[model samples]
Target: MTPVQPRTRLLFPLRRRATALAAVLLTACGDSSTGTGQPKSTLDQAVQAMGGAEALQAVTNEVVEASGSRQSPEQGSSISTPRHLSNFRYIRTDELDGDKLHIEHDHVTTYLSPERYQFTEVVNGASGFVDGKDTVFTPAQTSGMFTSRATAELGHTRLTSPLRVLRKALANPAIVQEEQDLEVDQHRFKVLVFREEGEPELRLLIDPETFLPAAARVLEDQPPLGDTVVEAWFSDYRDVSGVKYPYHLRITLDGVEAHAEDRERIMVNVSVPAQSYEVPASFQPPAQPVVPALADFGKRSTQLLQGLKYLTQTFFYFDQSGLPITLNELAPGVVHVVGPSHHSLLVEMKDYLVLVDTPLFYPERSEATLAAIKAKYPGKPIRYVIASHFHSDHIGGIRHFVADGGVTVLAGEPSVPFYQRAFSNPHTLVPDRLARNPVPVTVEGVKTLKVLDDGVHSVEAHRIQSIHSNDMVIVYLPKEKVLFVADLFNPNLFPSNQPAPYVWGVASGGLYDEIQRLGLDVERIAGGHGSGTGTMEVLRITGAR
Candidate 1:
């Protein structure tokens, strides 16, 4: 699976100063005078804050049990809810020079032990493999990736386990310190913030009376969300045979929260079996489809024009080979782009050709489409490329075609600044798209544009005031009575019976109203990412009164 980039938004001004203030505090703490002269010192304070060194060192086995609820909202205020349960185990090992640790967390065994090691995850049946180095044990399920490398500074001693959070703080005294109190659930806790430059602040809330941690909060390093925090609550401390355990751990990200239970039976000391850290012999990776190089780019091109086409008349589909390999081609010179994810269209113009959307980002697909266009239209040049929106998928390939001298057009409002910033500096993500061809971009207005140089191909770059995106545009061929649009309606079946109004609801239905309102006389519509080509009745199916 592709790694999702971290959603990091930093509020600049105050955050910059706060970062500097945190640095000064950490630097001051490094002074020998900063240490509390109580026989134990800061290192001992951390160990006592947890259970103790001997108690922590005695921990041989640990188990965690947890449960949580999840939900995803769909169109029309609909939602899907899923609940899950998990169990976790950790054991010390002499495998990697005795410092190695092995972790097996079941819900189906997601996270692994040892700081910088490879691990696999199976969460709610979704499986993924990760290979990276780390200082602390990593969780299998995460809300998002950390934008900075601050996690590398995290010591095992900072974690809530026997000798866990203390071990690192003892070795690095500047890592943890006490802070002001914060009240929650009518109880006050002494908040102590951990410092690691350039990283979000990690705050541990300790119960004032017991000095036991009540919760852990990591504030976003950036300002606006500087106070925006993710927290994990630890509770139900139980000590067995000198080893301490927190029976319950609840994590909250943004507003969502999940809880897990710790080991039912804690083992203080036992000989762990060998081969525990080894990858399971029965482990198997999920089967992934072989993607054709250029085909992925072709899929991306189709996704840009979704809100335009609705229930289909003659929709087109492509096979896996990415061959323009027709899944089902219904007519000549008109193609509906249909894939598993988005929508699109293919228009064979008089001389060169016009493509409606470019949704996916595949190096080979862009090349393949250009190659196919060349082969299909022997001497014609692909003079124009239309983008329906500014979404990454829709406009990802604009620079590719623009490099080829193809005049790229977008919805005037947002597209101007978008393309300007996007292509201001030469695009480097994928070079081949614009390698041999470099073209200028044209921003189309909220009106009609007709190109009669080669054929009667009209461009109706209208505004789609829809929830999908603001800068949405569509291409139209009045002479052919075919309109190319994206994200409007996805025709799963040719001549889809689903009403356009019901398909896109108020937003796209308003767009359908604009079609008739503008008097384009469209008869056939090709969608942005899915199968296109729709009859006049299909358009009327969602028309406004």
Candidate 2:
């Protein structure tokens, strides 16, 4: 497809001048302001100034080819350095016609780890399909809590696009308002706000002098991240066939940069194939990817990887977001990392640090927790890691401790084998601290109960079998009178108004009985899945025998 040549005389009177003189020129239209006779609507002038509604309607297929560096931080898997981002090359192509659309994206990164990711989506009318070669994504996967999400979203996007969004706002004069008096990052702009009940509220900011679009903002809402402000800035305006288009684009989520790209060329109204938007007849929806179990780690299937990333996303909103670690002082030298939905304990002893139950989606959680502990405690080296159980979720990042130095890992019967397998599993896709820095996984298997004390502080790993698993272990701190348990005493899953399920993972009175049988002083009860509460309070409320 050939780009439309710009009307040199009318559109380029100012000729995209040098830096200083460029500030005085207007790129969009003839000129209109308060001093002008009839105040031409900013949006109308903007639409016409950029080659009008017809130029936009002419675009059936578009290809944007650019070369720039993309940030790739294998987020939750790193230990020593979390902020490291590798550069990558990428290409994106999009096609649209009536109610059909197709999108293809390819990205390859060669850095601390070498990998390739490709994603393609096609939507024809009400049908849609998405597939990609992602190491963390498995085949036959469906997205949604209880329904399909990709199909619904892609189908809607097919009928609506940036041009369509702009057209809809212009078609409804009542929803469009010429507004101004808005300030963002200390820069004031004249804006046209478009408000529709069911559609997104969009605000288009224009340069006061040129009346050209400077930025656009959309208000999007969700449950987890709440109402988010998505904004994009347009810069380096260039004439592609008589039409003015932005060469540089930057999109930000909340306030963090999500994408930054420099467009080398954009070809519109290109030839598109019929199969581009057609969904195959033999498509079978795969269930949503979930964080995998320990066994899934070695398989390196897409399902397991998607699950791993999704699990981490469930706790931390975005991969680039900072670690959310809030330390609750359980007692002197004993701290509970309460920020993660999946918690961890940082125990400081006279000679070393003992972290019990490194939980959450992946290595990033453990790495963050380890950093927080060392930052606060400073010189104490972590010598022992008390892995409470074998459940993969309870100890996803146990290897971070091992990678730090010579750390002895303790798990109960049956779980130690899992520890060995997890420690030695293949991690070529998403390598972690232990994977990058080879270290011997020192782990101890406890049969019934095990105890370790260095005169100042003490910890005991007890194998307390429950309906949840035959090899569960509970951690106990004697001097602090605080007892830590995993699935056996998770208060978060407690039934409201109903009896303790006493079924499967939901614990029973056996935990209470065990506490009494051991004659352990347990005033405060901490957990791997629930809020730490008083031992008597949990027993009284849950009626734990």
Across 1-545, the per-residue lDDT of candidate 2 in tens digits comes to 11111111211012222122223223344455335556566776677656676776565566656654433112212111122222333343455444455555455543223445565545443345556643322443422221122323332232223444456555667887865345566566667787765344577777666556777765432111112355667788776665666777765544545446687887777777777666565442333332223222212222223222222221122221145888989999888877545677778888888888776444556667778887998888888888766544667567666776678887776655556655655444456676677667577877888888888888887877564456667888888888887655655556523335423123546677667787877888877766755464565456445
Question: How close to the true structure is residue 96 of candidate 2, measured as C-alpha lDDT?
Answer: 44
Local distance difference test scores for all models: 0.43, 0.55
Candidate 1 yields a Cα-based lDDT of 0.43
| lDDT agreement of model 2 with the native | 0.55
Kindly report which residue stretches of model 2 are placed more than 4 angstroms away from their true locations once superposed: 1-301, 305-323, 492-498, 501-506, 540-544
- Report the number of the highest-lDDT candidate: 2
Q: What TM-score does structure 2 among the candidates reach?
A: 0.45
lDDT string for model 1 (1-545, tens) is 11111122331112221111222111123221335642333334445656676565555444333333221111111111112212333322222112233433222211111122222221111111122321122333322111111121121212334234444455466887865456555565555677755333467666645556677665321100112234567778777666455667665433344334354554545565654433322232224222233222222222111101011100111222254423234356656555444445566666666666654443444545556556656776655566676654454445555555645454436444444534443332234444334334454434334342345344445555554555566666666677767666544332345443333544446667767777778777766644546655665554322
Sliding window of 10 residues with minimal summed lDDT for model 1? 305-314
Instruction: Give the number of colliding residue pairs in candidate 2.
Output: 17
